[model samples]
Target: MSETFAGKSALIIGAGQNIGRRIAQEWAARGARVAVADISREGAEETAQILRDAGTEAVGLHCNVLEDASVAATIDAAEKALGPLDIHMNNAGILSGGNPQDIPMAEWQRMFDVNLFGMVRANNVIMPRMLERGSGHIVNTGSFAGLYPFAASRVHYAASKAAVVSMSQNLALYLKQFGIRVSCLCPGPVMTSSPDAMKHFSENYVMRAPGSHLSVMTQQQTAKVLSDGMEAGRILIPTHDEAWETLVEVAADPDAFVEKKHREFLAGDPGRPGITQDVIDSIKA
Candidate 1:
């Protein structure tokens, strides 16, 4: 085993499946003791078993990001099992897709609760400990949708992820004095294990530029990209080349980028019509 992460301990929320599972495995392979947490106890145990089979020390625990008690208990359990955490990966999130007007207010709230506020909860519980230790790293999972607003139906999901990006940026700045680092992993469409999820993403959330190709990476590939970014201490880890380019373009010229997107929306050639003006007006009302 590599000594890169030797003597370190990691806790990955949502580690039971897909990209999160891959990340947990990667961390373990690099010599870190790991805690695999998920809403499903069985899933978490399965992931832990895989790591143990590979000669890594690991434990599985149930964690529901929507519940405060669950988050606290999971963190406590992880520490008890693996010692004080040196790396925290907040990877718990859910996808929400629908026309903005069609989505209920409750659903929007739920999305925020799980995708954004869940991260807030984790940081609240973990940052102080990390600060006291004076050495730690936090990796928050955002998304390409958050970096570029292309899917109108995924407005809630994008908003939640964008908040994560902002939160990671500010946390990086604030935690630097404490010798702690923060990274936001923003991956484009990744091929998950669930075909239903992939189909839903393809039909509702995938976005592309005019005449540009859409690329999808497997979970392992996404995990490798994120691991590389974290190793390099990059604050914003965009897994795809096109996502990085789009972000750079938007940063260089916000007005021009919006104008171009508007033209694309009008032409019906690029971008998805996520919500209508009527929905916006109604929300304002």
Candidate 2:
């Protein structure tokens, strides 16, 4: 309806559901041709069909961020269907919870492979073409946990996302001269399709902080915030007030703030359980 992105083309990895799917829909509504890529072919097709039904040019492609070949193939397919990409959203990620010291090496590697390395894989394939075009926007989805060290159980996830934040910042600085913009969307808790994700977050992360009041947004609401930020050319898209405040506090006094939060977390959950198969399985869904 807005047509702000008329004639633009976007590739959204992880567009099968949740925030990624919403972003794809929003971009198509704004008149951009979209490629919805996901590990689930059915999900990707469903998203693309929804866009097509709305009179938008859209395609569905299978992509597993863990595989470099898959990433390259998906990019090729997207470009073939939607023309050259003007926007790239690396939104695929997995969640894992446990004490860093206790989580398995394999699980840690898996988390990094999907959450952090997956971003690298997509950027590696798409950034050069974007550079050659002399203009593009790359939005990497990060987390509030990445900004601060508050979520003790989500160590692997937070670490991977923190790397993403750092990578996006450096990318913005490196590519600004080339007419490319990079942004890190660091949002607080959002309503996800995972039935128990909200409950887990409420019990583990949100309520752990005594006076910290963080609002949870629906997927559509979060998508709108990110879309607005990307359109406005913002470098760091902080979607929640609490996350912003935490970022500010950390920036002002990194050591003191981090130490205080670490103490608070330990004080609140002294008996936090170790990484169990059920805990891992819960997040897998």
Candidate 3:
């Protein structure tokens, strides 16, 4: 909508901790009515308390994104408490560890349920109202993995995020005529929970330089960029400029990005991991 968040109503799903909480705090600072939803009642209450302390209109609700009923009820609660939804940020996500093959089916399913279906559920509830209102903004949380499929570390997570990209693009096109905007925030290594995130982004995914190719953006930097991108109605918000640059390069010549990454990986780039050679050599067993 507008660059100003003053008087805007924002609904943030999974807004209890980490990136989600930070976004809520930032949005509140900008004078938005904040509705915090989490699977944990206490967690949502905690975030709502923080927002209220800042004098922002705040509401807390427990929502399980995997459940249709819970998601529907959450939308009703948010509108009833905070007014019409002006912005919806789908940031609820879970990251899995190890190779996908080595992981269990149940583990993979749950991760997608939160990260993928969570977005689906949020849009399912919010998009209709947005369409009726003839104006709204949707920002879905994706990852760099959605762009680069070589992320063997978390295949299911990557797949879920890729689905997010597709959904976002489609929605952007379908809703553009009605003034509804859909954007995807594909961030690299954010400093969220150590376990909920892939290893703290090291140098492995970068080019052959200490501060080149790829780098992790601090959470605050990320929030600001995302906020700005949302205001600009950017369809794909890449926190690291390299991601969009590489995508463009790949579109022109696929081998350039691949060969560069292979050369960097072969050059002993740690790539967002803090592991030393000794730690790398040691087995978890």
Candidate 4:
């Protein structure tokens, strides 16, 4: 593909580790100057150093998306260091898991505070600037769970991501006249961490069945998908082939699709892990 991103300036929040870091690397590889922002100062600097070593103009900044002041400061520092951003992406989020009934309201609110409102906060800061400039692209990290009913035990997480999806699409409609692009990146499961760590997370938190993870891609692989989708100007970018296929199934027969997934959940299928009181208590503890 042609270098669509060359000479552009990009800012990625939550670029300290995993998918966000990989996406930042992808931007640099495409010849864009990048700012790596994360809650972890060390991780942000480490990512920035890696990009700098590779000869990319990059800066590391501390950005806690939950805090308005932090978000404002990070964007200001990045723009001062690297020029106005051509692309701004919000990738900060957390995954919490438990049965819907077992999870507390506080936990649900916390998830929204990070997953959905984090993007809202960044957009509130960046979108006005973009509107004045008459050009910019915004990417919000969502999950496939938000797009479908696949996440059996993660009701709160799914709800938060669903809100992200809604917000991104609507924002796209409103921003199109101003030449601002919005993309909601919804990927199924990317192996941003090691297998052991992911397994531990699933067992203790998500209650996902062992061997249930299918079509898991590396961060590089997932980033490539995102890059291609963004280049194509796709508003809703889903990484997995199965995600597309299942969405089609759902569209064709909503009742049947929901029924099948419900059955799978009840039957303790691969995606729907066996849930027990012990798992719920562990999550609570």
* C-alpha root-mean-square deviation, each candidate: 8.3, 6.0, 6.3, 6.3
**For model 3, which pairs clash?**
201-272, 202-271, 202-272, 202-273, 203-271, 203-272, 204-270, 204-271
lDDT of 1: 0.81
Q: In model 4, what lDDT does residue 161 have?
A: 92
Candidate 1: the clashing residue pairs are 152-274, 153-274
Task: Tell me the TM-score of each prediction against the true structure.
Answer: 0.87, 0.86, 0.85, 0.88
Query: What does candidate 4's lDDT look like per residue over 133-192, in tens digits?
Result: 999999999888898776667778889999999999999999999999999898776655
Taking the tens digit of each residue's C-alpha lDDT, what string does model 3 give over 21-44?
Answer: 777888888778999999888989
Q: Write the per-residue lDDT of candidate 1 for residues 1-285, one digit (tens) a residue.
A: 444367799999988888899899888877899999999899999999999999999999999998888898999999999999999999988885666666677877988998889988888899989999898999899987778767665677788888999999999999998899999999776665443562132345334432235555667777888888888788999877777677788899989987887777677666422333443342222
The TM-score obtained by model 2 is: 0.86
Model 3 worst lDDT window (10 residues) = 202-211
RMSD of 3: 6.3
Alpha carbon lDDT at 103, candidate 3: 62
lDDT of each: 0.81, 0.80, 0.77, 0.82
Which ranges in model 3 have alpha carbons more than 4 Å from their true place? 1-4, 194-212, 273-285
Report, for all candidates in order, the number of backbone clashes: 2, 0, 8, 0
What is the Å distance of residue 111 in model 4 from its true position?
A: 0.2
Model 1 lDDT, residue 14, Cα: 88
By TM-score, highest first, what's the ranking?
Answer: 4, 1, 2, 3
What's the alpha carbon RMSD for model 4? 6.3
